[model samples]
Target: MKIAPDVVRAFTPTGKLRASINTGNPILAAADATHGARGVSVDLARGFAQRLGVELELLVFDTAIKSVEAVTQEQADIGFFAIDPKRGEGIHFTAAYVLIEGCYAVRNDSPIQANEQVDRPGTRVVVGKGSAYDLFLTRELKQATILRAPSSQAVVEMFLDQGAEVAAGVKQQLEADVLPLGNLRLLPGRFMVIQQAMGCPRSRGAEAAAALASYVEEMKRSGFVAEALQRHGITGAAVAPAA
Candidate 1:
């Protein structure tokens, strides 16, 4: 696909592709002491920059909310995030390139044996603030109380500190975070599947959105996404199907 000159300018007015990367989500990216950041999203950012024939500058943030803010506010040219209507207000998202499960976890002795048991009255479910799970549960849960953590990485600790009955977030994250804090078991199945996608500020216009969206679709079709996940040793996330 031929990228129009204006579209390239929209993405790189400063002559570099500024990519907002959220290190909080773990499944997509994380703080790498030696490299600044690393993960599937980082790999994709590199790929997109190369495709646009520009330098890649990673603007890393610790939480999804911050990452989304950077892109929506146009502080960065693009970002990787879960697809949500609230976020869509200022960003145009590509169809998902990776799918992650949103699961519930409880103390091993807690009576929350299944996903169905989580929304009971008096049950307090802790989630990362402004996270995809938090946004989701806030709407779907009619009875359970939603406790917001400072960041997705802190959900497990907050759950423990507050004695919340359930902790909710990316399945892989929950699994790894709960390892040291043993006696936690993930409830059977998932509550939602997160659609991880690439997005650009809506002000970038439809052409830029189409270009980024097309790039993502090709990445999925070429097995680049699946390979990146495997190379990073990321588990419990699947390459999204064709749109």
Candidate 2:
């Protein structure tokens, strides 16, 4: 069913459901501003609103935890982030449309040249708190000391400032901007596969969930998904079928 534009519930300036953006990438920021919102998350929310015939409201938060909280508390309808199964308990996730890889980023001068190099004792890795990379490090890299930051930028900053031996997060994001402090390098191997999806409150019923899922499938099949990625200059990655 095509979502009618008029049937979507209107959100007040301070509405119940707010859309959030990570704010670390320029593309995300531009997407938000394209629709007079604030980030890619907001743009995607607007797209959903248009598809479903609903009005959208935008919410800006500094961290992913806050974004997730907005949805859990019913302050927002959904959040956009890399998907992790462990996070499933806190909210419901639509099928994943983007695949990201978690890997280590180190300065060119750093001795670590590969993913295996990071597992050695005494290596300090910086990761954003509550991020997929953080969870991966906690569970997979037991031997390394992990430093938690509030955002991906903070993690990148730590690496740039030489605060840690490694910075771990989405490879695409890490490679987006130039690092003036030093050349950034991705470890030779991936730590985990990250599937980014839209997350809604788990309290919603199956019917609503299915409707959202079907909409995502339609976007994929109709080429809207590929177009969005390309519009953002996100090449070299395949848009997977909605998970």
Report lDDT per candidate.
0.93, 0.67
Which stretches of model 2 miss by more than 4 angstroms? 2-17, 25-40, 160-162
lDDT by residue (101-186, candidate 2, tens digit) is 77788878888877888887888888888876786678888688988877766778766666688888777667753245457777
> What TM-score should be assigned to candidate 2?
0.83
Measured with C-alpha atoms, the lDDT of residue 7 in candidate 1 is: 91
Candidate 1, overall lDDT?
0.93
As a whole number from 0 to 100, the lDDT of residue 204 in candidate 1 is: 91
lDDT of 1 at 238: 90
TM-scores, one per candidate: 0.98, 0.83
Off by over 4 Å in 1: none
Which predicted model would earn the best lDDT? 1
Q: What global local distance difference test value does model 2 have? A: 0.67
